[model samples]
Target: MQATRVLLELAGNVVLLLWGLHMVQSGLTRALGGDLRRILGAGLRNRWTAFLSGMGITMLLQSSTATGLMATGFTANGLVSLMPALAVMLGANVGSTLIVQVLAFDVTHVAPVLLLGGFLAFRRGGRTRSRDLGRVAIGLGLMLLSLHLLVATIAPAENAPMLRRMLGMLTADPVVAVLLAAILSWAAHSSVAAILLIASLAGGGVIGPEAAVAMVAGANLGSAINPIVEGPGGDGHNPAARRLPVGNLVNRIAGCLIVLPLLGPITAGLQTLSPDATRLAANFHLAFNLAMAALFIGPLPWFARVLTRLFPERVAVADPGMPLYLDRSALRVPHLAIANAAREALRMADAVDSMLRGALDVLHSDDRKRVQEIRRMDDVLDRLHDAIKHYLTQINVEDLDERDARRVSDVLTFTINLEHVGDIVDRNLMEAASKKIRRKLRFSTEGAAEIAGMLERLSETQRLAAAVFVSGDIRSARALMREKEVIRDLETSATEAHFARLRAGRTESVETSALHLDILRDLRRINAHLVAAAYPVLDQSGELLPSRLKHGATHG
Candidate 1:
């Protein structure tokens, strides 16, 4: 009856510990919000910065797995380089040891005070900081309370013949103990929980020094499971996604092998320095992670090469059906979502440019094959436009700041213009092709040359527009607007020349002239949208917009 009561108490303590860890992790994630991504994005400029960012983020969140997963997502999205992500993962491992250190301290007396303060703060406060503080207090209190419960329950178990026999069996084979610990930790999905269990057993004399050390090592190896499983795999065909999990697996497996042999000496040396078995186990956990990181840091570049060789990058298909910017997970971080939207807009610009080029190809050649290729290109642009619209609708659901809202608005407007560009190219140009194929409608020599030249200028302008949007270059934006005005003037002049040719009976088809005018109109509208897309970025940067210049406005 006493043993049954003790087991129940131990089980309750474990539940409290798990709940506290969950609350802390949840609160930290909510408090940091999208800032985590921005910090990581800006900080991954070099290997050292990435490492530091990883450690800082993990320390703040109290979860190395979260930091590593975020890094993996960024790498998969091509936002950060692979080497920097690996560096960050290494740093996260080091930072996660801080939790174990905190758990090792004797703070049971302060548990009630922490719980009371945390509950009060959580109930009264509305701000993120207050909530975060409450979470920290709750986590600390529960950890201490659990330790108290564990010590109380397991202290009596030390003298039990059955418990002693079980402990002896575990100690008889350290390898089996290590394997058992690893399996339990993996099953629990919480290394901290596993470590806490070891700490509690060691504190109550339920497990010996060597057994505790083995368990600690095993828990370290088990912690890698979450990262490997949660990594990118929906598109496993993508080489980078496959490499991420493989690299993490190799790192953990190598760390385990190196530590397995040293476990006996490590525990002995620590025990000689400090008689406290729990302290020795905690130190062993810290030393193992730090030592493994130091050992692997130098060989990271070589590891990256090996990962790349094992999973070479596959070529991305130029299929317009793929929406480059519309990753559902991106909504969790609004800044990344905005960046992705801008990238998609640039792609839309390119699609429009391709459609225009296809039209020009049809104008230049009477060949049926060239005309058919243009039709295919038009289909591609149409698909891209549909995708952009759907992506924008999804992104709209995320709570965006003022600047991001304006950017989203600009992208939506730009997509509409690009869609119209596709329409003109597909409808008007295809109609002309059909007429030429069926009725053998032909343009005079001057008409053909003039139309081809105008189409070439239009395609060049589209290319520049895409470049300006992608690079976020103010100079390029201004140049695009100026070139657009030139295209407008050239279209006007070309229309007059074609009218003269029609009046003098030099051209047989007035319909071709009208189609040329319609194409120019659509091109002008597309350029206007491109200019609008650049406006918000320029305005945000304090660059004068064309409207501001036209109004003769100056900031005070």
Candidate 2:
């Protein structure tokens, strides 16, 4: 009965620890919102900045895996370069050591105070900042409290014959102990959890400093698995997608090779400096990570080069069915996922613009070959549109902050407009192509030149609009809105002129005149959607409402 009660208590403590950690992570993510991404992005401009950003983010969130995953996403999306990401990962290793340092201190007397303060803040505070603070406090308290309970429960058990025998078995084979620690850390998806378990065992004298040190080394290696598991998996052929797992595995393996041999000397040195066994173990873990980081920092550029060589960039087959940027593995970090979604949306916009350009080319030239090519490209654009919409829907299910929610909505809206733009181009240009092929309809030289000039303007505007959206340039975005007025006036004048030619019998056939009118309508529609794609950027830059663009007024 006593043993059963102890087991139950241990189980409860474990549950509390997991729950507290979850609350803390969620609260911090919500409180930081887009600021987290902006800070990390800005700080990654230089090596030192990247290192500091990585350390700061990991320490605040209490998870190196989270920090590494975000950096991987940034690297994959072309937001941050490879060297900066490596720098951040190195910094994350250093920051994680801080957790072990905190655990090493005897804070049992202060645990209850933190717990009380956290509970009070959670119950009485209304703001996001206050609630997030409460979560942080409660999480720290629970971590410390759980550690206290773990020590009490296991310390007495250390004297039992069965427990002693188990300890002897682990210590008897240090390789097996290291493997066991690696598996445990991987299973938990948390190095801190694994380290804390080792610390508890060591504090109870069930595991000696040597065995504990081996486990610590293994824990560092094991923690890399989380990033691998969270990387792009559905289509493994992508070079960037494949690099996620490869880079994580290589870094961890290299770290293990450098650290394992030094463990004995490091632990012994720590023992000599700090007689307290628990503090000694904690210091050893910190020293190992820091030393490993220093050793690898110089070689990281070579490592990245090796990765690039091993995974040479392959020309991806154009499959409309395949998504260009939407990878579910990104959902693990919501901000990065949103960023990926935005990138995919930009690609979708580009596809639509390309289709519109193709359509305009066919309509002006009446070329059968160009018509067929445009139809093929439109089919591709349609496939990409469906993929992006489905991807965004999946992302919407995860918990998102207000800013991310708004961004998702904006992406969805932009995708819809882009799809409509593609449809307009396809229907109008294809119809014109059919008439020209069947009847050999020909326009006057002046009429052909006028339409070609209009097509050029449309093509230029589409290209600029795509650039503005992708670059997130408010100046270019607002300029796109302004250009819409010009496109509208040109479209109206061109259509009226074509109609005048038809009424005066200057054009060849009535069908040709109808096709010309439809082509003008399609150009106008494409421009409107391009303006729509730029709306979010203008809004983000604190510009006027989209209604102003539609109404051609500054109605602020």
Candidate 3:
């Protein structure tokens, strides 16, 4: 009964620790997610800048795991090079230990005040920012309260015979002690919590100095495990995001290993700094991570090169839509301006088609960097959209003949379709890709092939539509309009096929149902945009219908 009671009390405290960490993570995310990402983005210009950025953000977030995940996303997006990103992660490790240093001090007196103030602010807050701040305060209070509870619970264990024997066994085998602490920290998903438990145990005389030091080493290594295991790299969440956490884990493990054999000296050194066992553990945690950052800061480039070889960039289809023909000086001449707009419109078409061709690659590949690189090309489409819009607006319609006036209208309509195609690709299609990569999802082979076939047809039809936009070719315009129907039918067929696969108990189909349908729908949208580009040329030629049915036609 006593053992059961003690176990339950320890479990409850651990849960409280996790709950507090969750509150803090979510609260800060809501308040500063975008701004922090932007900061990290701007700071990745070099190793020094990236390291400082990592340190500053982790200090604010108080979680190296969170910073590592964010940096992974940036690397996946090609915003940060591997070397600088690795440097940022080094600083984040030091920053994470700072939380332990702060939490080790006696702060339970403020828990009640923080809880009350946070609850009121959260309840009465108008802005989302205020509410998020309230959540942070609440998290802080819970953490302090949990710590106080832990200390109280462990105090009674000092005189317990069974507890002392267990502590003695751990003290006898420092490696076992280290491994147990690592497991405890990994399970808790917060090294701070694990360290706090060790500190509390040590302060109560349930653990000695050497045992505490070994456990701290394990706890440090264990902290690295949470991000690596939970991070996108291991779960297939995203290979691009995996590098930061994996590199971090390697660094932590190396540091822990180097210090593990020398626990006696390290503990003695720490004892000189602080006689209190809790403060020693906290000081050791901070000092070890600081040493890691210092040791690896200069060699970050070499470390990055090692990770790059381990997680090399996947081969992706080269994007072929660079708009070199968009001459700014040509805009003053109406004819040259129209010609430039047409050329830019063709570039947009090429981009849309290139994105469509890569759609299947997004579905089947394990390479997250490749997936993000493809998505990043959509920025070019936005630039082309703006350039074409401005260039077309500069043309004088009054100076154009009736034929050329109609061409201007056709070109403008074509540019809008081009822009829509880019949006669907970047927003809809890429979002689905990110979801799949993040979730480690895949489509069934048959379903994947079905979507692939439709995208290819759409890409060809889009190319023809682009040609028709510039040449005003009636036959090609008619063909594009017809292919629009093909895409619509393909979407319907894929939807039905997906359901059939789901009914047959296909795991891939069930897992990727949302992804498959979304990609199909997005392709149909792209086809619609391409088809619309054909309408103006067809209408001017007297070959376009207002709808599928004539005015007097009867419904089936």
Q: Candidate 1 regions off by >4 Å?
A: 1-87, 99-219, 233-236, 257-282, 298-305, 313-345, 378-420, 444-457, 471-506, 511-514, 538-550, 553-556
Best lDDT among the predictions, by candidate number: 3
What tens digits encode model 3's per-residue C-alpha lDDT throughout 401-455? Answer: 3444576778878878877887887788888888887888877999989988987
Alpha carbon lDDT at 17, candidate 3: 77
> In order, what lDDT does every prediction score?
0.71, 0.73, 0.78
Better of 2 and 3 by TM-score: 2
Model 2 misplacement above 4 A: 1-12, 22-53, 73-84, 108-172, 205-209, 232-234, 238-251, 254-277, 298-309, 315-329, 393-399, 443-499, 506-509, 534-556
Q: Candidate 3, after superposition: displacement of residue 465 in Å? A: 19
Model 2: per-residue lDDT, tens digit, 432-549?
7777777888765656666677677877787787787568776677777777888888877777777777787874635467666776777777778777767777777666664674
Error of 2 at 270 (Å): 4.5
**Cα deviation of 177 in candidate 2 (Å)?**
1.7
lDDT of 1 by residue, 28-97 (tens): 6555646886797787887788878887888776777667667776887787778888888877877777
